[model samples]
Target: MSKIIFVNLPVSDLNASMAFYEALGFENNPQFTDDTAACMVWSEAIFVMLLTHDKWKTFTNRPISPITTSEVMLCLSCESREIVDELNDTAEENGGTADINPKQDHGFMYNRNLADLDGHVWEMMWMDPAAMTN
Candidate 1:
């Protein structure tokens, strides 16, 4: 069986968070969603679990990281540089902060950083397949 990754995030507002991800093309799996938690599928293999503060405590006793601080920055790949830009633009329109870090463009690869409403950062990138062969 192929391995699948589930990234669990603590959210301040479950409904808002779900909407934010939905704006970026993530689909919610109602079978795994409830008042306290939501399952957002980014792809067949990548799933993000958005949990409320109270629900988060059940899995870990660690204090919720402040919105001003970043514990980790998650990265996702786009099909093209244009797609990267579009996703970042959508994020900004949906309450996310876009370009939290300076954009990176290396001819072969391009990237932009966006932070969700709860301050979780996502690095959207695109790489040239032709460049990989050279």
Candidate 2:
């Protein structure tokens, strides 16, 4: 059984995609590095498998979702409000856009949205562990 969770995304450019994710503090798994796909490690067990459009097509015959028309949004949790801002800023510096309104800071949790160069939406957020129960 596979122990790691892989979230695959279709990308237009491998280098740009890698750089974008790296700016968000992800490390590339060299073992899986290749011309068509890259394994990005977010945590020990969490990863994002980014594939070029051509490579992604090999896995499914179904139509790929256009970022604007797609129904999927990738959500990632951070350690704190500052982390949320840090990730978003990195994305922006790497050619992504802050496609949504700013965070709704509720003291215990903070959240915001960012759209990558491919227009894929990612939720950048932080939730206080201490406040989760109260």
Candidate 3:
């Protein structure tokens, strides 16, 4: 069986986080969702579990990071530069903070960063397939 990835993030507001992710095109899996947690499906192999702070502590004793701090940066690839920009815009429109870092365009690749309402950094990028061969 292929290995699947499930990234669990602690959210202050489960309903808001679920709405934010939905704006970015992720589908919610109701089968795995409830009041304290929401299962957002990025793909068949990738899922993000957004858990309320109370439920999150059940799995770990570590304190949740502050809103201004970042524990990790999650990056997702887009099919084109336009798509990257579109996602960034959607994120911003839906309460995510966009342009946290300077935009990058290296001829072969383009990327931008945004922070979710809970301050999780997410990088959106696009790369030219042709560049991989060279």
Candidate 4:
């Protein structure tokens, strides 16, 4: 089987978290979703597992970080700069915070940061495919 990536994040509220991700355009995979966890599918190969605190604790002994601090930042690539802006705007409309970091535009690439309701950072980006060959 091909390898796939699943980003598991601890969220205070499962339903709210699911809504937040859905707003960013990810579809929920009911095959692996329930009250305690929601399998949000970004693509066939990329999924984000939103787990409630109790469900998350099952996979770790470490304490959950307070909302004031971030343990990691997740980045998603968009087909164009406009899509990045659209997603970021949707995130803000769905109770997320947009622009945690200043926008970065290197001509060939652009990105903006947003914080989910639980304070996890999601960076939306766009890159020119031709730029990678230069």
Best by lDDT: 1
lDDT of 3: 0.93
> Evaluated with TM-score, which candidate comes out highest?
1
lDDT for each of the candidates?
0.96, 0.85, 0.93, 0.92
Misplaced by over 4 Å in model 2 are: 99-102, 132-134
Off by over 4 Å in 4: 132-134
Clashes per candidate, residues 3 or more apart or on different chains? 0, 0, 0, 0
Q: Please estimate how well model 1 matches the true structure, expressed as its whole-model Cα lDDT.
A: 0.96
Ranking of all predicted structures according to TM-score, beginning with the best and ending with the worst: 1, 3, 4, 2
List ranges where model 3 is wrong by over 4 Å.
132-134
The TM-score obtained by model 2 is: 0.89
lDDT of 3 by residue, 9-128 (tens): 999999999999999999999999999999999888889999999999999999998999987988888889998999889989999999888999988999999988899999999998
The ten-residue window of minimal lDDT in model 3 covers 125-134
Clashing residue pairs in candidate 1 (N, C-alpha, C atoms within 3 angstroms): none
What is residue 88's positional error in candidate 4, in angstroms? Answer: 0.9
> Clashing pairs in model 4?
none
How are the candidates ranked when ordered by lDDT, highest leading?
Answer: 1, 3, 4, 2
TM-scores, each model vs. reference: 0.96, 0.89, 0.95, 0.95
- lDDT score for residue 112 of model 2: 84
Candidate 1 local lDDT, residue 60: 95
Q: Which ten residues in a row have the lowest lDDT in candidate 1?
A: 125-134
Question: 18-116 in candidate 1: lDDT tens per residue?
Answer: 999999999999999999999999999999999999999999989999999998999999999999999999999999999999999988899999999
**What would the TM-score be for candidate 4 when compared with the true structure?**
0.95
